[model samples]
Target: MNTAAFSSLPLNPALLENIASLGYTHLTPIQAETLPPILEGKDVIAQAKTGSGKTAAFGIGVLSRLEFNRFNVQALVICPTRELADQVCKEIRRLARFTQNVKVLSLCGGVPFGPQLGSLEHGVHIVVGTPGRLQEHLRKRSLRLNHLKVLVLDEADRMLDMGFEEAISDVISYAPTHRQTLLFSATYADPIREISKKFQFKPITVSIDSSHHDSVIGQHFYQVDKARRMSALGYLLAYHRPESTVVFCNTKRECQDIASTLDNCGFSVQALHGDLEQKHRDQVLVRFANKSCSVLVATDVAARGLDIKELQAVINYELPWDPEIYVHRIGRTGRAGKLGLALSLCTEAELPRVKAIEDYQGVAAKWDEVAPFPMAYAERFQPPMVTLWIDGGRKNKLRPGDILGALTGDAGLAGSAIGKIDIFDDHAYVAVSQDSVDEALAWLKRGKIKGRSFMVRKSQWG
Candidate 1:
């Protein structure tokens, strides 16, 4: 959509300011095609890859149509995890920056339910949340979706893959029958098709793909003995040191072990898996997204459906059971026309899986012998000694500014002296520069934000 066309839409003027401020010179392919249909209240099942501006397409539509003064949920956006839900909420808030009185609440598992229930009692116009948490709220009689006019299933296939189908159905059942339904996914599987068949009525369909699988990805594989794999991975990380990388593991135990080994080797690391509590999972994801933690040791299931822009590399510690998943794993990088790197360590036993992946992808992945091990690289891996999480968040009207204020203003630390600040629903996370850790902690313990003292510590913001 052109700027003039966007201006002509029935939207708040502040939203327009936000749009122009964000330098949205023109709409992306998905945005241009999906915006008009969504504006018309039509059901849509759009297949668009990450970084195609799909979030803005739906966010603006929902914000434009939300009845801000109704004091009831009018739009519901369901995501697979707290991280993605928080991200969606942030984007929607930016689009609604000019829209007055638009309250976007994020309901996800992790934080206490009392505060969420209290917020519900007050009122909310737009609800963005995980499927299970939204269902929980509905069961508790806190989130009233009876007035919902739009139901959005973002990353729909991922939700299904994560076993959220039943919860999604229950939440949607609470919404009005005439509500508009919009589904977005990286791929359209049969289960997703089943969802569309039942919840979406004659929806307009959209799919974006490259001419060939290899056209969209850069692929590579490496042959190594089983015992030397970890050392080889450590050497690779130290040599290449991509800005952001996701290390794919086959099992949760491996994810933890590799992360532990990397930490002991002097690298900042974190693990993402279903075994973690919702709150810690949110912290790990936030840190990864913000570059506070550059390496994510994750199971394929845990890493699937994550949408992180600017990921530089993908290292396969374990080949997936499915070839398409291998494609998806590497596809995390090389997204949006950016050149990407994919490296895999193939043992003699796992060469079959690597061959299967390459064969299924219809592309040849070049392999090379492992060069001599580098003790210099392995020596650099030191675990991040500490991480800090602030008790304040969006739910408490916390902003990055507030967290910064408490850190640099009252706490009297230099801005550069602080690290990443990730503010979510019921909390905010701030990384302290190793140089200023002690002082930062002491200053925080003595200061107040927004005229109130908040709980601050070296822990996840649960």
Candidate 2:
């Protein structure tokens, strides 16, 4: 049966209608291939990459089988990182739109455990979380999966590579033996197979060729001396001048070093790593997404679960040992039908890794020379907006509308002059056009938001 149109599937009519309303016209290759066995209550091992609609493939299955009234967790989705877990939970919520009263919760590290425990106590139908944090909850007896109907290991390969095998195993031990298990990964490697063998019950295998993104992503590789890779990265940035870019680093230390180096050199850059606190991480992401920062240097783990629209480029500061990881890193760009640029800085010692990527993709890489960063390209790469920090946020009853009203209303600024406004517990960050910074700062300094005067200052980034 052709399941191309979502209506053709055996999903709830409301789900089908909801998807149609959400602009899902047809099934993605992964969804078309995997949803059938999944909806039939069978375990599945699917080989699909990110942005391949794998989340929806598993999400729909989990939503369909959910017993909302049961309250206990009926399905559990484990991701390698918090960002991915949050994304998966959101996808599940969207799919469950028609399923009334369905509750989906996200559990991950770097968040307040108290809030998670409260949400658990209130009851939830599905739980999406990282292995380590999920294990912590289970150990505290705060999360129970005894009634779990489905267990999903999203990005199982990356989870194992990140050394979550023991945690994952411990989480699975708490689930009932009769439940369905689904493993989804970008590659069908030995570890993935091993995970499937241990967790899945005669799981039907589905492999979808996900080279579509490759067509839209323009990939280039450049050979540089080890010490000159950072210089090459700066030159590439100035030459390409992508509005939003993610620079991939092999380690947390490297991410921090590159971010600091680029910051000192006048590039608007932010570093994302596991070592960052949740609050600081949130601020960095907000700044990058709101256009206050132009470049984000992130390790693979820290970069996981980030979904940015219209991302123009991805720079590989260092090549990964695993070819699959290379694919994953470059996949962050070239999304939403937009053309993307992927630039990799390779060294003499990393030639084998480059070849491994070529063999994995079955295509010769496009090699290019490092373009010299002439003075003409210098001004083209700076970020166009600056972030303003407000000391008041949700805790102080500060809303985005209040801030916007303060700026465009009392401050007499145009609505178009403002970018994204992110509100957190005790602070908010607003992006303002560089041209209006002086006026914005002056106006904000004297203005009152929501009828109350609060201290405001321009955010200083390094």
Candidate 3:
């Protein structure tokens, strides 16, 4: 019952103003309970799911204590994937906006090291990165953490699941022992506790569940023969027609097969797995997040740290052996007060596993029959947006505003026609309404951005 307002806390005036401007009046449970300890520079282990305002809890703490004048690394936030790292970096930057000369950099894999090295050479205040890339930089002596005052491990459980224990250990070894450490994860498993014991010093624990799972997300299980599992999945998709869906497969091969089948069947689909090159992986994630792809087929490992906002549904093609993962899978949807749907296809052999899930959740599973397969001539499912790849990006000083101006100003397209715009080191991806993709592409190819012409092409997604 600690219903306290954020103004009650001793936060910087500018930060308080920023929070208010962002429409946050009161403190979330996680922010109320954890921000105090975090701001006090005490070690903490917080158990909060995605979209629980955990980022701001930690972001506010780090930004408040930042030494902008020093210009050295003051905070280090390690994430499980490049996507999550980018997201954390963005949130932290947003929180630090009112604070002048505060620089936040994200260092992750999938991009070249030369640029990262270059940025490190220039110096930054906070560093958000993945274990692998950070470890590489540590080994090369390109990144130094001696001045590090705060160390936050966001999504600690997902990092462990991705097999980054050794990398995390090595990276932590480089950080000074006197720094404040914050470990935040959705689950408090034994391994997480072990890590907290080893690295944290008498840390306080906080767990909050803002999402009432069963109430917000409708869950259903359908039993089908192993041979008809794909058919059942397609039938479920056709029936639900979720604008954006994530289908989880147990194996990489299955992930690819299902994506291929769906693509062939005229569903806009993309497959994500460890086998994909970094370039392809980035494209897949961008397309899905921007609504250019209706379905994303992914393995557990590849889908780790995926935080897709407004995700309509989650389809569990195969359940994981651990019930905890099952919780995490369905948790992707039903976020941000949105109603979600979770459909699972199980065969006879997997019935026992289904029971385990039911027992874990402490609720009897609801059984449902899949809708009959759609007719051959049925309207095909297509995503509302289409992605266009532009060759220029951060290196060329490209900004979302620049692209937006070109599209809406010269192309004469409405501002609403533009979707998510992501700028990388050397390339940028912009999502436009499918109705305006051709015009946007043509305009970009013909128009100059920032007084320079860069190649523009449509991204081909299966």
Candidate 4:
């Protein structure tokens, strides 16, 4: 039997069928290495990058050992960010499709606390959340881990980087000491090893190479005068004009400044930083993910846990101090068998950082010169899609299919004119092609979704 096949694992028949239905025939390297130990109920620490099927490996393990009959929290997944927590919850729910009653809930900050308390009151089988929020719930006695058989620290390094080490320890204090603990991180740094020593029992360690290949990601370094950095960025944007781009800034202030400058330069752009309210962060992420925004300026911490598919480019406005961070930033693009572009702007002071990166990757830096491009070229930089915000969502029983049906039916828009449709608890965002924005918006405002009226309007940033 091929060990790479999902069927080779000792999974429940229903789960095997669901995995096949979901089109996962073979295991990713990370999954193949980690799942066996995970399913065997052993403590494991795995090093793997994002988009590497790490979630499925852990999700399947959690589900396989789940006690659906008992409503208590049997498994806990701690993430660094709310976006990541929500994403993990969704993926686990999809994996749990084999059993509809396997309850999973997200407990993250930046949202209402009352709802989380209410969900806890009702009970859940699995809880995926940020460390801070989970610690809070544990403190309030609203959440208990006495029944937790499995505990997973997803992106453990990122959680530690976000200063959640103390909080993570606090949450762990409440869990059963003998339970299985799984730690997954992109980089196995010294701190990660320390945490593993402190928290995990004797564990199996699995590592997958996290390096990006030159053939997949084309990297270019441009030397610029310290004062001319913004112009160089504008030149790069105008010269390449990728459909979707993420500009990585080293600081929150720089992230906001670059986003404001790009927006002022007539580029559809948004900034993601720690300072923004959660609602604004959601809007920015939605616009960028739905292709309603062309450029996203974000700090590394702010951009953590962002899973954007088909990202065309990643630009480092300023080089990070660590080569590992550089590798992580550029790794966001050039995924899924598509060519990825990584452009970096460097000054005389930043050459050492570039050298650090070169030594880390074992490849010489590819240098390029930046020249001013015609400002008129920016006219073509407008995003191809426009997003419409609907004030009704899961709370109102509104779904993506309802919104899509309304637009394509009464709105008379072609299916191709519709883009990504995202539904939240109390609101939703639908992306329509720029040419069909007016038509979609008009129909959404005049017509009804699921036979009920909704407050619909064009997103301000769209």
Model 4's number of clashes is 0
Candidate 2 vs candidate 3: the lDDT winner is 3
lDDT of candidate 2 at residue 375, scale 0 to 100: 26
What order do candidates take by TM-score, descending? Answer: 4, 3, 2, 1
On residues 1-462, what C-alpha lDDT tens digit does candidate 4 reach at each position? 134899999999999999999999999889999999999999999999888889999999999998788999999999999999989999998988998889899999888899889989998999999988898899899999999999999999999888999999989999998899999999999999999999999999999988888888999999998888998999998889898999998889888888877877788899999898888899999999999999999999999999998899999999999999999999989987799999999999999999999999899999999996443324667899998999988999888889889988887899999999999899999999999999888887889999999999999752
lDDT of all the models against the reference?
A: 0.79, 0.86, 0.89, 0.91
Model 2, runs deviating above 4 Å: 1-3, 211-214, 374-380, 392-418, 421-423, 436-455
Candidate 2 displacement at residue 227 in angstroms: 4.2
Segments of candidate 1 deviating more than 4 angstroms: 1-14, 210-217, 335-338, 348-362, 374-379, 382-398, 405-417, 424-428, 432-462
Per-residue lDDT, model 4, residue 103, is 88
Error of 4 at 343 (Å): 0.8
Inter-residue clash pairs, candidate 3: none
Number of the predicted model whose lDDT against the real structure is largest: 4
- Report how far off residue 162 is in candidate 4 (Å): 1.1
- How does residue 154 of candidate 2 score in lDDT? 92
Best by TM-score: 4
**Order of the predicted models by lDDT, top scorer first:** 4, 3, 2, 1
Error of 3 at 297 (Å): 0.3
TM-score for each of the candidates: 0.85, 0.89, 0.96, 0.97
Task: Determine the C-alpha RMSD for candidate 1 after optimal superposition of all C-alphas.
Answer: 3.8
Candidate 2's TM-score? 0.89
Residue 30, model 4: lDDT of 90
